[model samples]
Target: MAKWDNMLSMLWMLRSGRKLTAAQIADSLEISVRTVYRYIDALCASGVPVVAESGHDGGIRILESFKETPLFFNSVELKALVDAFKFARGACYPYTEELESALKKVENGLHEEQRHDLSHQTSGMDVISPSRPPSVVPLLRELEQSAKEGRTVRIAYRKANVEQADEREVDPYGLAFDRNEWYAVAFCHQSQTLRTFRVDRISRLEPTEARFEKPERFSTSAYFRNQSEREREADGPLAVIRIEGEPDTLNALCGHWHLRHYLTERTDREARFLIDVPTMNKYLPMYLMTFGTAIRIREPLELKRRIQEMAYGIAKHYENDPD
Candidate 1:
């Protein structure tokens, strides 16, 4: 098991409020007694306040202060947690039932005055989505189970822009949620390499009895970091767009949650963007049009030509409209 997983298991045991000794923890987790002690040291270093008592009858436990506080959250901590759940709920979280129940339990533990205060604080915040996406809860659960059990699953997957569904066997390593989407990062037997498949795109999933050992040093985070570096080095077409707008407008463009990763550089008077899309097709035109006259394509005459053509088409359509 990974050190992180081990730590989490230990934390859960301590959270149960039952006295657990290093020997008991090692036996349950099937790890060495020394490892249990090391994990305890790590927890203490990270401010967990895990108290260890020395003696034949003594054991380890979390500080009593945590037991009094619900999940060890103060009023401020409670507000932050509620705010996160609020955004996730508004975005149509897949596990809506679980989220609601958990939130209720947390609030139930609070005093009546605390609940009233939280209600006021939450009313001032909001997360708005045009439409709720379909729930990915079923798929999420299967993927999590497969990852934990080290089992291979046959998944019926639909690739983007492709209508046909293909079946493939994958060794699940971990699941990741990003940009309001969930993905399974796993070792693909079909592609003979690691690939990421969107959980929503998976139409059907069937877990198999076949199990595989996770690679010794494989990490989803490291894999993504290496993939990003490789993409940056790839030979791809680039477009330099000069942005001239107010400071706030420029900040808005840069600070957009989804667009922030693509931005390479910016300045006070102007900003330069490196476009990766090969063609100035529908996606590029539609995106650039959002900025209106505030942006100009500095290079790639092809892109400028396409935008001009699109602008002419729009003008023709609205030529006879009454103002």
Candidate 2:
């Protein structure tokens, strides 16, 4: 059971015609008056129309309009919430304490039968995200708060491979978590464009007083999809590049999100992938060399030529030439 069950009980108590003092609520709930005040703060934070009163003959009560409204979540809906929380808890997001606390409250609200159903759902499921540094938790919390309030945030961000951190002011849109990491999608004022920042790479964060309106069409899912499409297109027109390789090589390619989706055919011996390597002349050689001779490029004579040039360059490096 959640220690903050008093929040619910206090709300129910305030729903009656009589206004209740903090001391009265504390006495009824058998907790300290200070605890009652904390529950009231929490209720207000959650958007409850709780009004506080002071002086003699004064107390607290919820708005009259809220009393008659009955809100409920069915078992399936509750289970969905539990599952989501379960996944999030495992995601490498900072500030999981609040999420765990909220999950506990949700669990405490469930009936025994519904809880049994939730238990069954939770028993066999697990999510595993790579570990993150403890320092990033505060930054994540600030970013989340800014996103919720539509406020701006300033941060010193460094890319994983970059040596210098850049100061940026951003309008936080939303956050995303994958199996490997957490990301914040934001519109950057410095770049005059939107960018994604790895949460762990953010070295410093501060919420600013400036607020911004979120674009109507902006969504994390859509943004990522479009970003990916642009990258694939930027490399030039899509080409059908077929490779003959061992099964492990195909499995390795399938591990990549873009490559996996475009994988048209797969067999124990080989796999065919249609991809756009726009910078083929620059990167194709390096990429092919990664798999060594285990793979062979079967199409697009252009890529084959580039690969040969790369191999020739490597061969030349070992040759003894007199100037």
Candidate 3:
């Protein structure tokens, strides 16, 4: 029997309200008497209230109070546990098999009515991800382990738009997930700098005997956010973009993931953003065009001209076609 199984059997035997000697428990569980003593010590440490007496009446017995105390989770706690697991599973948590086994044990401990209640509570609740996530479970598990153990690993990483994957060794500091992608924040040996890698882009990963000490208090999410801020700053001088529209429309535009960060001011009928020239030329025209006449660009005549060009191109593309 497993260590926990033997210990649980000891607990049940001691719970019988009869004083049982160490020899008796050891004999019943087919373990050494010293092992029984160790199990008793462990149970006591876990607040089981096991009483061990010495002398002619020396034996072990669980406290009567503990024997009567019911071990079960309340309805609210059970529902929370199940719902939390659902969210974790949806996020592609690395320890899914262990999580499933733990949830099964929890459910098995419930009474039939409690089980029915749990099923009913969980039936109406679920975590719906945006799309089916990638199969990076194995990569995640390996990176997580390496990060925790302060180990370095070699990987064949392919950057975006790159054809061939490049081989590099890195000391994985941590991992983060954002925008439906997994990223590893590690110290790249080749670059000799801390960098983030898209986990799915990793074509191959192998453990290395080399080890490294991760910086103290390093946070993957914080690093990623900092990198984004740095990238935005590196985009050169930003142009102040002003727009006027319905209050609701301006609000929605300002709330855009990219624009929100650059937003400098807002009013009932107007919003201002600090946008770079390249971004203004590349993405804003097409995106803002979706708003149609509800909004108007109040500044930066260059952007207005780009929008006009795009609109004219669109009209020209279908000019000779039937409506």
Candidate 4:
């Protein structure tokens, strides 16, 4: 609440690899640019390596060594900060504790009013923890342990689509949960390839002493965005499809595959969209099948043909297998 604390906080934030202009800082702190300039002066005088650059892209930069430097935020500020980390934790189970610890420090620093405000704000935006069963928790715990230890483990898994099951030996790297499905990202010892294993579908897990190492450049975000149970893609470039349909029809396919939610949606009787698709592009074909009468594909003749073929095949199957 004090000017000195706010200045320290602002400097720490700027050091967190973010650049804030005087106007932006003033607006955020409900202060004037004149005060921000004073704070910047103090930081410079205090041996804080604050660099301000004048360009369209540059504003300020605190060199890398700034992490070892000092910054302060009271407990209330810290708990308030946990909001983003907790919001993002669904994809980064591996980083939630580090996020929580950072939040704890801020929480410990907050005064009573600040703490009350934070508690109210956090409660206002409640996120119910996913309904992970107790039995599964232990398995998840084991998977997490093995992942961190780079330990090989055997998992008995079932593929939902195939309605079949098998056992796999894998070198676990990390665990992630999306919606209701939990997945383990790991290297399959038998397949000698990286693959994702669904947690619930895992019938069994056996931790082994066989240890391994994660690849030096493994990125969980990249793996999550790229890997999912989807229609097999025919490789090349992202399949581009021109789709014309009502907004409702198109919205369902917005986030699918290489399909980007383009800014090109337009409506007459129908909305027109330019969608990028994965190589296989199942959504495009199946979608065309779903709205056989309502939607049309205006480009990519191969997709149009596939839609036609699918309809014909479905018609024939229904007629032949009238049971």
Candidate 5:
């Protein structure tokens, strides 16, 4: 038998709660007495709780408490682990291959009936991503490693609306995923400020010898949230967006990601949000138009006028077209 197999067999023998001598174990396994002692030492190092007492009436035996405890996961635990793996894979987790290998070993330790139960439970449920996820595992792995090691990296990043990628050296603090996109929160040496870069927009990344000390209690999520809040506040002066509509329509409008942050009040037929005037005039008009007659803008006559102008423009454009 292979070394591992022999050691496992010896463990099972000790688990029988019998006080068998080293010579007796070797004789049963067709190995030398010294080999039995070596296997016992290996099992102890692996946390098997094997007890080898010397002298008469003293023999190898597993601890009573250790023998009573279950070594393999139950059905519920197995199902949760497999389902979590599915979600992680859907999110493009960088360590998915290693996670899968670890899960397989866990499953292999289960009984046949437990495995069957897990298969049946997981087959009926799955996570459905809203869109096809981007393939960014390599980028995620590299950034994660650099952040963990406190190392700086140079990246060729293409920002939105820019035609060419620019090279920048940044100290990657951490990575975050929001709204189906991956972002690296880092400190840019060129800009001398902390910034967020879209991982998918990075055209090239290379490690540098530069290193940095991460701040104590630094939280990537909190920093990202604060940045978003500051941006919203910087748009312009706050203005009330009052709308009267069907209950469901109002609910949907109030629940919008951008609008929800500013939602002030809601009723069966009305929803009120406190957002910036520039944002309302520049972006909200077209989106509100989608609701058509189902909703009515109750305040900020400027928004209603903007929506009318957009509708008239659409009407005239289509009227003049031949097709």
Candidate 6:
């Protein structure tokens, strides 16, 4: 009969200064008056301060100030909350213990009927992410707090492939969880240059009394737009080239953030992209085959010649010719 469960529900319902008679409680609990009285005794025995007045105008009332009472849920709400946690479990952030503890409270609070529906046959779901050694979630939290409060912070940051960590004085602007990686974008005090530092590689944060002003136009979205290296590639010259490829591959390639602002096509087999590209990185002939015989590079003869020479070099790699 979920005796204790029903009594707890009754206490909560009466907590709002609303009186509930034995008959109403009994009907809601699908039990008899005799059982209701016994449950009321159970609550009082547990020091819940449940008061029941007798006679024609008697009812049940619990002393106020009870705030942590378990919530009442039907089957639908229970199912919805379960689904919510199932999805959160996929995010795979560092809240494992906390999330499970919160879920347990929900588990213990469910009414008997709803509990059955929740525990009934359902497919178990899981999230897949490469658990690359633990990273500092706490630092990200502190970084966010500092940025939001307009405070300055210090961090020992080591760039990728560097030998040592350097003390960086940064005025925090904002953090981004882009494509599953966390980036802290801010102004570097040492270099007097703006930079984006990866969150995982950051170690040790110290908050200081020094206050720093965030740039007025430092919108995170706008900052992200300028992160590409293509625009900064020497400013040597801009070139447009057309190539042909299958539609789906072209579609996926075109949508890449680096390519999106620069690509277009006249037909499924043919497309064009303009890149603010540098010179030394080109290996021409090999790059041309990327279109798989259906596409051709139509501009900048130097780029096309580079492609042809690279193809010859590659052919020489497998040929019997000594030259």
Measured by lDDT, the strongest candidate is 3
Indicate the residue-level lDDT of 283 in model 3: 80
Residue by residue across 1-323, what tens digits does model 3's lDDT show?
Answer: 87766877788888788999989988999999999989887677556898989999888998878844324466878899999898888878888789989999878866577789989988998888765435578999999999999999999999899999999999999988776667899999999999889988898899999999998999986776566566553475678899999999998898775667678899999998887787777888999999999999978999988899999999999999986
What is the alpha-carbon RMSD of candidate 5 to the true structure?
A: 11.8
* Tens-digit per-residue lDDT, 1-323, candidate 6: 56556877777667878778988888987889998888777666445677888887777887776554545555656666676666555544445558778878877755455567787722454456545435556777788889988888999998899969989789889987665567889888998978888887787789988888888877865677666543554666667766556787666556555655555455686667666657224422444556455546566676667777777787888898755
Tens digit per residue, CA lDDT, model 2, 1-323: 24445566777788886889888888998999988888777677556788988988789989887744233455667667767776776674565677778878777755567679778866776676666788777777888889889999989999777899999899999887643677899999999999999998998888888999888877887777667666664656777777788888868866665555456788887777676677444545687777878888887888878888888998899788765
Question: TM-scores of all models?
Answer: 0.54, 0.53, 0.57, 0.53, 0.59, 0.52
Q: What is the lDDT of residue 234 in candidate 6?
A: 68
Q: Write the per-residue lDDT of candidate 5 for residues 1-323, one digit (tens) a residue.
A: 86667887887788788989999999989999999988887666556788878987898889887844324455677889999999888777789999999899888766567778999988987877655335478889999999999999999999999989999999999998876778999999999999999888998899999999888778888886576567663567888888999999988887675767678898898988888887777779988999999999998888988988999999988997886
lDDT of each: 0.76, 0.76, 0.85, 0.69, 0.84, 0.70
Best-to-worst ranking by lDDT: 3, 5, 2, 1, 6, 4
Name the best candidate (by TM-score). 5
What is the C-alpha local distance difference test score of candidate 5? 0.84
lDDT of 3 at 51: 90
When 3 and 4 are scored with TM-score, the better candidate is 3
Ranking by TM-score: 5, 3, 1, 4, 2, 6
- Prediction 5 TM-score vs. true: 0.59
Assess the local accuracy of residue 81 in candidate 6 as a C-alpha lDDT between 0 and 100.
68
Candidate 5 Cα errors over 4 Å, as ranges: 1-77, 127-135, 161-163, 233-257, 260-286, 292-323
Candidate 1 lDDT over residue span 1-323, tens digit each: 77767888888888998889889999999999999999887666556789989897789999877643224345667788888887776655657678878888888866567789888877888877546335467777788888888999999999999999999999989877666667789889999988999887898989988999888877776665566545553456766656667777788777654355556788875666665655334356777777788776665676778788889999999999999
Please give the distance, in angstroms, between residue 300's alpha carbon in candidate 6 and its true position after superposition.
8.4
